[model samples]
Each structure stands twice: as structure tokens, then as C-alpha cells.
Target: MTIPVKNTMDKKQAITAAIVVPLIICAAASVYFFVGSLEEEHEDNQTIVIVTIVPQQEFVEKVGGDKVRITVMVPPGASPHTYEPTPGIMKEVTKAEMYAKVGSGVEFENNLMEKIISNNRNMNIVDCSEGITKMGNDPHIWNSPVNAKIMVENICNGLVKIDPDNADYYTQNKDNYLEELDTLDKYIHHKLDGFSNRVFMTYHPSFGYFAKEYNLTQLAVEYGGKEPTPQVIQDSIDESTRYNLRYVFVAPQFAAEPCKTIARAIGGETASMDPLARNYTSNMKQIADSLALEFEE
Candidate 1:
């Protein structure tokens, strides 16, 4: 029997849909792949850098701008003195072209440098603490804006070494960031000047460089990287009494109970500070402002 005209048209329409549907799908897939490839190329063009702390990430960004990607080995809220990297983190390190180490005896770097270098033999090591005078074994050099300036310069140089084509771009950003740090130094000095009680107590001695730079004293409850002993706690309390210190500072990465103990003994309270913070400029200002209030003898 001969097929009806309407039935023939329906069969033809069905055949057309089968052909058009797959063509539409293939076009969408091609676009998706093209966009994905562009994204991968963009990321591959950027230099990979590994740093030990959040502040170093900040320093690298200020100097490297959009030309660098940073991986921080010591994650946020973890103590660099005690942090151990996971297998995943070590894998990330293998992709890095540079490792910007604090190199001022930061415990994390001291313990992991040998292994990190072994993992990525091609990774160029950048000593962010280059040319800075270390305070004995103290590694909290980034607390002082002056030291931060030096660290930023080191980071800028490292970025330039790996990505020379962007050297001018990195240098411009570094100069601008250095000016900001210099301004920060002046701001801290203005906030802290003329305060009678320049002694600030902390649970950890994370502000030693800061105190040294500002001509203040950091009375730490913890001594020698150990939790406070009764004698160390008493010593901090006695120093607080002697210096008329009204606050004991506690960091995000440390135990606050020890600092609180001293604060309670002195009839004072504890304050918040983060030595390994990400927002370097604002964090340092907040620290200076906090200390200025307690410095009112």
C-alpha cells in the first residue's frame, strides 16, 4: 500500500530531528572544550610559587600581581612552628617554579625545606628574609613593616628572576606596595609614640621583631617555644605589674588559656592579634592600635 502524504512528512520530520539534535550537541561540546582550553592556558601561563605563611602569599601577590599563583604550605589557623604538610600539599609543591621561604628560622621551613627541595629539584628558593637581621632565633620578622618592606623586595626579585618578561610590571607593583608599607611604618610609629607602657604581653613571642622595631618590649608567657611553665607565667605577670601592662595578647594560631591566665592575674583582659594574618596592612594597623590602647599607663 502507498503511504499517505501526512505519514511521509512525519517520517521525514523525525529523520530531520535526529540529524539536528546531534549536531546541536556537538556544537555545544566544542564550545565547552574551547573555553576550558583557554582557561587552562591562562593558568599555565602564570608562574607557580609556594610560600610557608599567609603573609608571604600577600607579599608575593603584591609583587607578582596577576603573573603568579601562590600555594601556602602552612594553612590558615595552623601554627607554622608545628604545621606538617599533607601529601596533597607536597604534590602542589612539585608544580611550583619557586619556593619563597621565610628562611629566618621559621620552624616550618627549617623542618620541610630539605624535603620540599627534594620534591621539586627545579624550584628556585627565594629567601624572603634576605638582608634582614634576625633577632636570635625569632622568625616573626614579618610583623614589622620595615622588615615587610625588605621581604616584599625579595619576593619581587624572585618573581622577576622567573618571569623576566614581567619584571617591569612586578617592580612597579613592588614599589607601590613598598610605599604602602613605608606609610604603614609611619602610621604605626605615630600611633605608638609617647606611650608610657610600651611593654605588650603575648602568649607567644610573635611580636619580638615588632617590639624591637618600635622600641617596645614583648613580654611573652611562652618561653623557648614551649608552653608556659608556672615560673614563666609568673615572670610574665610580674613584668606586667612592673610595666603597668593592661593587656595580654593572644594569637589565632595559639592557645589563649596561658595568655588569659596572666591577664586574669593582672586583672586585665586578653586581646586578639594574628601574626600570620593575610591582610598585612590592616592587620599590622590593628595590632598597633590595640597596643596603643594598652600602652596608656
Candidate 2:
């Protein structure tokens, strides 16, 4: 018994529908899963990190690579001694999974630590200055490459704690950055080697740690974090004369008038030096170069 042409056509259409419907459903399911996976990957790839200064931001970027989103509390040209965070910054802090504090008793940290902890109760707080030798309450621990090595170690530990899956990546990056820092240390030493004058002058006492590291003395025009008195200015002039210093280092965060005056009094020039610079290696090298210029025999 032969089937009619219409009957055969109906059977063929039914078979095609059965095969295509399942295939279309499978394709849609695959697409859904692919999109969901991409979203999950994107979420897993990034972490929100908070830092108190630009240098700390650099450290985080070095170790965290593309995995971190940094929010620096102390912007460039603003002294950490007097920085006040806005409500928006606090809101950003609340969203951060980690807060890498300078942790060396900077005035801003002293004032904002409580609020920062309150804002993000569960955020991991990493003290970047944990093992560094303090300079009589000096908070510029990152100034010394030796101290910076410790800070980077602390930063890496904090990163590993929060993101264990990426621990190896963080460790590798930390190692690489540390090697660079070591090279920086050696370069500074090489530049300042065999120098006649080991003393340098600055507007602010920002380079105490750097001075300590390189066996140099940093004389500041400012005293007790205050503007120079007439006597202090005279004293600085006398010291500059005595040391025969050729340059006075001025930072962008502070007024340069005092440094310029002292420099002029001693017939020297004022040079810009930023200890809070974001480019860690280059900043140190530049500082070394500036000091080298003054100390050239």
C-alpha cells in the first residue's frame, strides 16, 4: 500500500520540526550559558582596592595587574598631613574589598582610619609600613626602597588573602617589582657613590627615609611642620652656607618660597623633588640624580 503524496510531505515536515526544535533549544541553552560564563568571568577578573596615596596605587597596580581597581584617597599635590576625604570617596571606600593604608601614622590616616573601618567593616586593611623602621613618627616609609620592599610584601600578602586563586600571579608580579626596586636601590647608591657632600636641603622633611637609606642628611627649611621663623630661616641659611649645599629640594605639595630663599641666600638653586610621586623607580632615581648634582666633587 503506497502512501499519498500529502501524507509523505506531512511526515517529512514533522521529522524536520522535531530535529530543528531540539537543535534550536540546544543552541539557545548554549548561548545562555556562554553569556552567563562571560559575566561570571568579568566579575571574577576585577577587584576594588583602596589606597591612601599615589605611590600605594602604583604598588597595587604592580602586584594586582589588571585585577585591581584603585581609588587613591590622597590625590597628587595634596599633603597626606591635611587631606580630607569627601562623601563620594567614603562611598567608594565602602565598596572596596581592601584598603592598603600607609599605616605609618600619617595625619590623614590618623584622622580617617576610624571612619574608614566603620564604612567598610569587612574590608581587609593592609598596613604597608608594618616592618619598616620609623623615623620619629615619620610616615614617609615608601621613600626608601628598602622600606618599599616590606610594603610590597605586605601588599602581596593582603592580595593573596583576599584572592587566593590568583595568589601565584600576585606573587610573581611582586617578585618582579621587588627586583626592579632592588635595581633602583643599587642605582641610587651608584649615583651617590664617592660624593663629597652627603647633606641636602629641602623645603619639607619628606626625605628622611631616603636620606637614612643612602647615608645622606636632609636639612629642612620648615621646622616642626611649621613655616620658618626669622631665626629658623637664618639658621637654615647658616646651615646651607656651612654645608655648601648647591641645591634646595622643593616639593609640589608645599610652598617653595622658603627653599628658594634659602637657596638664594647660599647662592644655590631650588630643584623640584616629589617623594610622593607615583612612579616609584623613576622618582627615586630622580631624587638620587638631584642629590648627585649637589654632591658632585
Candidate 3:
């Protein structure tokens, strides 16, 4: 061994190379598998959608379940009538695969539709209010559960078109949600049944569709998108008194002063109601509960 030092060193080098080469190859294989799995998981993530308002987002969630991510243009407690999307929100819209539009002449939708389409020309724009009958350009179609079912159907169709592979999944979810809507409708009917007063007063006329569905009358303080004049307010107060309205429904999105004044004039309390809440089913139920107060003995 002392006479062949160079040979001994060469043999050791050869052993080291043999060991290191296999280790490198094994490490490379592991890294490749890990990266592939990460890519697959990325692909499995939910599809992104852009909706006009919170209620539309709720509808999408009910129909799409965890398979979709929603970005709403009008946040909770914000009025869709005058919502303006920021630059960052527009950027978000560009990345979305679909836009679930209220599509019934919502002022926000009317103002931003062109820009929204331009941001993502390939994006599928689905009108959730497609089949509903309009109430003189009233865009609050989702206020009615029956109309909400139609919207969900439109949403499901849009989802199926975008992701045909998950058609069955989306369909099943839509069916389940529709059934829930039906149950909600029945519950609302039962709650409002046998009420002495079928009329309710609100500062904003967000419940036209709901009132129509339940065979009730909605008297609004604000008409034609303008604040009522003093005379008009007095007339509304007189009407409220005549109808024996117990509550003046005030939306959180608007100033409560007018509602409060009307409530004071009529000797009634102002109750808060949010038409733009993300919890669609619960909001509808709450509206029923509020209206039911008028009929209570």
C-alpha cells in the first residue's frame, strides 16, 4: 500500500464518484416527482368568478360549492346602484373566467359592462336575471327566491360550459340549491299567511320582486331614484299611517335619516334590512320575519 499511494487514491476517488452519481440521480428523481405533484395540485384549485354583487356571489357558491372562487364588485352594505370598481378590482376581473351579472339594468352594471368585457374578452358573461320579468327596470331580481332559482340555473349552465368535466357536480349542487329555494319559498308563504296587513314600507324599493312573489304590496318612500320632497314625505307618512305599518324598513346602504323621519311621522320603528347581504337564504328569511311583524296579532 505504501508503494502504490497514487493507485490507492485513484481507487478511493472512483468509489466516491460511484456513490455520488447514484445519490444525485435519486435526488433529481425525487425533485421531479415533487414538482409534478405541485403542478397537479395547482391545476385542481377552484375556478375564479367575478360577480356584480354579494347576492350573486352567494348564488354562485350555492351552485358551485367549493369548486369556485367569487370576487364581488359590490361588497356587503354597498349599493349596487352606484358601485364603482377600482383599478385593482378591474385587474381582478381580468383574471376571472366568468362574470355573473345581475343584468337587469343595475346602474353599476350599466356603467362598467363595457370596461369589464374589455378587460377579459374571453370571459363568459352570464346574466343571472335572464328569465325574470322586470319591474320597470328594477334590478333587484334576486330579492325573489323563485327568480333566484332561475339565476342559479343560469349560473350552473355557465359553469358547465366552462368546465364540462365537472358538469355533473355542478348540476347536483344546483338541484340541491333549487330545492332549498323551494323550501324557503314555502316557509315565506307560511310565515306571511293570514297576516292582516300585506303591505310593508321601505325607504328603498328593493323588495318589489319579493312583494310580487308573496302577493304583498311594497310602499316605497323614495321613488324614481330621488329623495322624496317634503310633500311626498308627508304623503308617504299619511300612507304609512293608513296602512298601519309597524316598521319602516331601512337599508344599511342608505342614510337612515329619511327612514327615521318617516318612522317618526308614522309613529313606527325603523328596522334595518340588508338586501345586499352575502347570506342570500338567511336574508330572505329575515325579510319575511320583518314583514311578518305587521301581521302579528
Candidate 4:
């Protein structure tokens, strides 16, 4: 329709309208797809199952691949030592088809396994620590590579029993992963071989299993299943200094400040290690490397 209009103004308005109309339509379509995708993702998240406990959860995901859904029971950054289960956590355990337990001093001190069984009577609770050998029932069985292999096998077996159809899949995964574990064991031994009569101190006594495997001595700062008192701290500092220790091992989930203070007091440094790391191979490698660097110097 040719109406009287300011020539340049009319042309500019027409161009603007032409550009804006398609842009609005395209934006609306894009929003529709984005919302649809979100909805699909939400549904997928709902369908996936959850696993409790960090170590077990990690092992399950490794062996299960995309076939299994897992959620860790302990929240990240929470101390498993003092973590207490809530009603909501128990509900999750109840819904879980299987439960993977470490059955160590940490969980026992916190009283975790009883809570899971008390809540979920029907759910199969598999002790990944089964068949684990301890020099004297040392709770840190998961620390050693050989013991970790046993744990992975235990997890794979649990998965098979839970989902029988996937037995072969889990078995195949177990066989492949076991070789990597054996490699880790060899690497650890090789690194540790340089240090005979090597000794270190830790905040918690969680490294006994690791130390035992490598013939190293780990003297814990907190001895009586309690946090160190002033006297205990002083005594530990003295002991570490006496040995001319190079590194003081600290766990990620625990407060390293006290240990750092002790290390500084004794003119030594602190090394952070994860007692509850999910990746078995990576965790072992890190520990071995840290120890080698610290002890060799």
C-alpha cells in the first residue's frame, strides 16, 4: 500500500520490521527446543539409579559404564568420620537395589552400616571389603592396590547378582580393570623399594594397609580414636621431628590445619592425600608418587 510517508523513514521502518519478525520467531523456536531438551534431561535424571558411599559408587560407575546409575551417599566435602545419616539418606538407601559398604573403622566409628541395614531390610548389602586381608583387621583395606582389586571384583560381583543379565558385561569389565590394578601394584612397589625403614606420620591412622604393603611405617598423630589434645599434639610433633620426617600425610576430608601447624612446628611440610578417593588407579598413583618424593628427599 503506497501511503504518504517520509521516504527514508518508511524504508528504515520496513527493514526493521522485516528483521525483527523473523528474529522473534526464531527466538521462540529456540526457546521451545531448549525447554524440550531440559524436560528430556530431567526425565533421564529421574530414571537413573543412585549408589551410596564414595568408593563403591566410583567402582560401580567404572564397571557399570553407562548401564548403571550411581549417586554417592556421603555428600562431597563432608567428613565421613562424623557424618550421620539422615532420614532422606536412609530413604535413598531403601530405594537402592544394592548397597556397597567399605566396612572400615571410619564407617564403623560413624556407625553407617547399621543405619543402612536398619533402614533397608530388603536391599542387598554387599561388603566390598569381603575377602580383604588385614595384618590385624586394619580398617584401611581399600588403600592397598591388591586389596582394591579385591574390592573391584566384589563390586562387579554385586552388580552381576543385582542385574543377572549384565553378568557377562561386568565380568568382562572386571577382567580388564584387574590388569590395571596389578600394574598399579607393581608401580607402587617399585617406587617404595628405594626407601627401607621409611616412616611418616598421619592425622588419622588410615594408611596402615598402604604402609604394610610397602613395608613402611605410619605413625598416627591421633592415637586413641580421638582428636589430639595439646599434650598429644606436642608428643606427636616431637616424634615426627625426632625421625626427621619430610612429609606429614593429611586426608582431604579431614582438617589439615592442625597437621599443618604441627608440620610447621616441626620444620616439615604437609602432603594432602585422599583416603576415600573413588578412582582406585589414580589415587594409588598419587599416593605412591607423593611418598616417593617425600621419602627420597
Candidate 5:
């Protein structure tokens, strides 16, 4: 006699199978989460170390690649000139193996800063301007390509000191970064060379050094000491009209009222330029390209 073959999933058995399937999915998800966490822990433990004293942290990141962890002492949109380090910031710096000292000129007093750094005997402070030719009281050295290369060199040296095992990698990255900066500088020069007159007006004197380096002229409405008096403002207006100025460049944080006033009086338009960005290569290139366009027309 042939045995009867039954297709036999009852309602109770089908319900159990559905429930078990969901439980298995949940179990797998839990396992995956735990494995991912372990991998993240390994990566964290393997990361190289770094700290930046200023917002020029971008430079450190570029040079350090995946090896360094950098911190910016000052936050974005805050003026570094008046940024006083808190107790917490000081504590962090004391613990760091290196500090990026982009603070020079009017931003802070060197003597006081020296005392602070001296107290952190374990920390080596690398002035980003090391081997750089400075232009003015504007501590925004990272704004220029030539100065940016110097900053990259300082960063590489700091990295080697912190993680000597990665010295070759850091050096290679530093050289590559410098080469790119050189190319940017040359490209900017080529673009600006076509302009007949490089004179312009600005609300702040932040670009004094930048202008000096590129053979551009800037007459400022604001100086480090004080704002121009009413008579001076009138004179500035007259000068702008006399020179037939076409561009009035203002900084990101400055009030547009003053620039607008000057622009209206001179029959010119306005442009915004920033000198404090850490990504100097791109920022400088933008400024150079924009200025070239403004002047050429």
C-alpha cells in the first residue's frame, strides 16, 4: 500500500513560521550593529593625532589626511583678533603634541602667547608663517598662496614630530600641496596681468598685504586705528569718482552700509571678499578671478 503524502502546513504552523522569520531578521540586525561598532572602535584607536590653534584647521586636515585629528580654537564667523581662549581650550592645547600658531601681529600679543606656550612644555608650537614672508598686521597669512605653502610645511613638520613613523607620508603630502599652491599663484598672476589698472576700494584694510604682493592698490575706509572722519569720507568719495573706480570690495562681516554709500557715490558696484579662510587655495583663486573680471570690464 502506498503511503499518503500530505502537504501539511496548518494555520498554527504557518503562523509560527512567520513569527520566527521576523525574529531571525531582528537577530541578524543586532549582530551587524555590534560588528560595525567594533570596526569603528578600531578605526578610532588607529587615527593619527593633531590639533590646530586656529580655524586654519583645514590646512592641517589636508596635510594630515586620515592620520590627524584637528581642532579649531576659534569657531567660524568669530573674529580671531578678539578670541580669548577659555580655560577648556587652554587645557586642550596643553595636552596636544603640537599647536598651529597662525596667531601673529594684531590678533594677539606675542609675549603673553609665548608664556602660555612655554607652560605647555610637552607641546611644540609651529608658527604657520614659519619660512613665510609676512606682509602686514593682517595675520590672515593663510589667505595667500605663497604663505599657504609655508603653512603646509609647518604642518608637515608638526606631523612628523608627532608621528615620526608617518614622516614620509606627511612629507609627500606637503610637497604635493605646495605644488598645487604654486600652480594657483601662477594662474592668478596670469589672469591679473591683463588688467591695466589694479586700483580698488575696501571697507577694511585686511587686503593690504594681499594687494601689496599682487601689485594691486587699495584705499581703505577703515583702518586698524580708527574709522575715517567725515572729511576723510568726503575725500574718499571724491577720489573714487576721480579715479572712476568700478569695484568696491567689502569683507564678509563688515556692515554693507559704508560700502554701499561709497558705491553709490562713485557709481560703482560692490563685491565681497574674505581673507581669513583656511582653504586659501580655492578662496584666493576665487578672489583673484573675480578681481580680474571686475577690472577687465
Candidate 6:
């Protein structure tokens, strides 16, 4: 009787395990697959953003976080002033939900905005320079942290427009970035506060807005976006000599022809300064530090 009872009990346990173990594993697998599918769907649904410049890429990424996939029209080591978006770059417009343009006379935007829209009329346009008073035709608006904050707000607004569900997330990221930019502005002010000579000479006049923000004068060896002519070089040398400026800044994208020549004439040296730098905050700090070196001396 005991043996028959034990055998019956063992059969019952085996049948339960055969049914319940498979059921539990199937349920767990279904949940895992469901969650994985949802994650894949979410990733597949990310908003496509096309930006005109490298810094715009940063601005959009900071605000958009994982909600947006960005394509920068002007790649690094390329000047937006003279860059044209290739057909391949324009193709991105087809999928883009938004286009964040450095709309302040950036040659790339000015040249291709219409074509970009033509490719995708549904694409929302976000002007990064929306709130700032543009310094004439200068496209270097993001050079100033104050202007950068405005750009970031504009970017956040665009992200919200494209992905309203994540508006709060975009807004929070923008707030954090704005705080960092404010700190950067204060740090630059503190670093350059007591400098008597507020003049900086560069190969390109890319820092006009930044110089204006910080009460500094930006002298350019490259005149009117062209390599400096003889007279322009002489004038730049004279200007730097007047301010006792010690360094002439040049970027990787532009020819340093007159920068070095002017530096030699003015008894200074040519140094690197990229206004279109992707690492905006750190680049600005580097700029401040470079200026501080010259100013401190």
C-alpha cells in the first residue's frame, strides 16, 4: 500500500513538474521577449535630427538625449562658412523629423535650406539663433555661452515638438546644459576679468560674438573670410601691436597663411582656436585659458 502510494505521489510530482516548469519558463520567456521587442521598437522610433554644424550636433544631443539620432551636415575639420552639404548629407533630410540650423548666415544653411526642405517638407526647422541678436552676418553665434543657452533652448523646443512624450526629459537636459553654460560664462568672466588687453587676433573673425560678450576685440588676419591680402595683414599687425596682443589664433580648417605672417610681423606666434569646435564648453574654457595666458603676462 505504501509503495503504491509513493509511486502515485511520484507520478503526480513528475506530471506537475512537466506542466508547471514549462509554463513558468514560457511565461518568463514571453515577458523577456515582450520587453525586448518594446525596447527595439522604442529605439527604432527615435526621432531623426539633422544639424548644420558640429556644435549643433552637441546641442541637439544634449537636449534630445537618446530620443534623437543626429546627422551633422558639416563634419569636424570642415568650416561651415564654406561647407556645402553633400547629396548624401541632404539625403538624411528624408528621414529627419527636424533640422536644427545655425541659421545666422552659415553658408551651409543659407545654401541648402531650400533643398533640404524640398526633400522633406514635413521636417520642422529649428533656428538655433532664434533669440539672439545676430552680430551682423556672423555665423559664430554659439561662440558665446549666452548665445549657446538660447541655442539649447531652441533645440529643446524642437525636440519637444518632435517627441512631445519626452518633453520633460528634453527640458531637464536643456536645464542642465544651460547651468553648465552659465558656469562657463562666469568662469570665462572670472578668468578674463582683470585683463587690461582685451584684444585677440585670429586668422578668422569667428570670435566676434564671443569677444563682444566678454568686452574683448577680435582682430582677424583673414579679411572678409578670405586669406589676408598684404594690406589686411599689415593692418592686422598694426592692430595687434596697438593692443600688445601676443598670439594670433588660427583654426584647422582655414589656411594659416596670413596668421603666421602677421604673427611674424607683430613678433607674436600663431596658435590654434576652433570656433566650430564640437566640445564647446571645453573649447571656450581653453580659449579663456589661452587668453588668460596672454592677458596675465
Candidate 1's C-alpha lDDT?
0.90
Per-prediction TM-score? 0.94, 0.85, 0.86, 0.79, 0.78, 0.85
Q: What residue runs in model 2 are displaced by over 4 Å at the alpha carbon? A: 1-44
RMSD in Å for model 3: 5.9
Candidate 3 residues 1-297, lDDT tens each?
A: 575998889999999999999999999999999999997776558788999989888889988888888899888878878778888889988788999998898999898899899989999999988888898978889899999999999999999999899999999999999999999999999999778679888989999999999899999889667877888888888998888888889898988898888888777889987888878998899989888887675
Name every residue pair that clashes in candidate 4: 51-71
Which candidate do you rate higher for lDDT, 1 or 3?
1
lDDT of 6 by residue, 134-171 (tens): 87777889899999999999889988987898989999
Candidate 1 lDDT over residue span 1-297, tens digit each: 456988998999999999999999999999999999999999999999999999888898888888888899998899988899999999998899999999899888888799999999998899989999998989999998999999999988888888899989999999999999999999999999887767788888899999999999887788667877888888888999998888988999988888888889999999998998889999999999999889875
Which ranges in model 6 have alpha carbons more than 4 Å from their true place?
A: 1-42
Candidate RMSDs in order: 2.1, 7.0, 5.9, 4.6, 4.7, 5.9
Estimate the TM-score for candidate 4: 0.79
Clashes of each: 0, 0, 0, 1, 0, 0
Candidate 2 yields a Cα-based lDDT of 0.90
**Candidate 6 displacement at residue 154 in angstroms:** 0.9
Q: Native-vs-model 4 lDDT? A: 0.76
User: How does each model score on lDDT?
Assistant: 0.90, 0.90, 0.89, 0.76, 0.71, 0.86
Which is the leading candidate under TM-score? 1
Locate the minimum summed-lDDT window of 10 residues in model 6.
Answer: 220-229
TM-score of 1: 0.94
Model 5 lDDT per residue over 1-297, tens place: 233322244656788989999999999999999999998876665433333333367678777888766666665555555566667766665656677777456455353466557657777677777777766466656666777677788878877887889899888888877788889889888888778878878777777666777888878887763656777778878878876787778876567677777888888878887776556677788889778866775
lDDT at 227 for candidate 2? 79
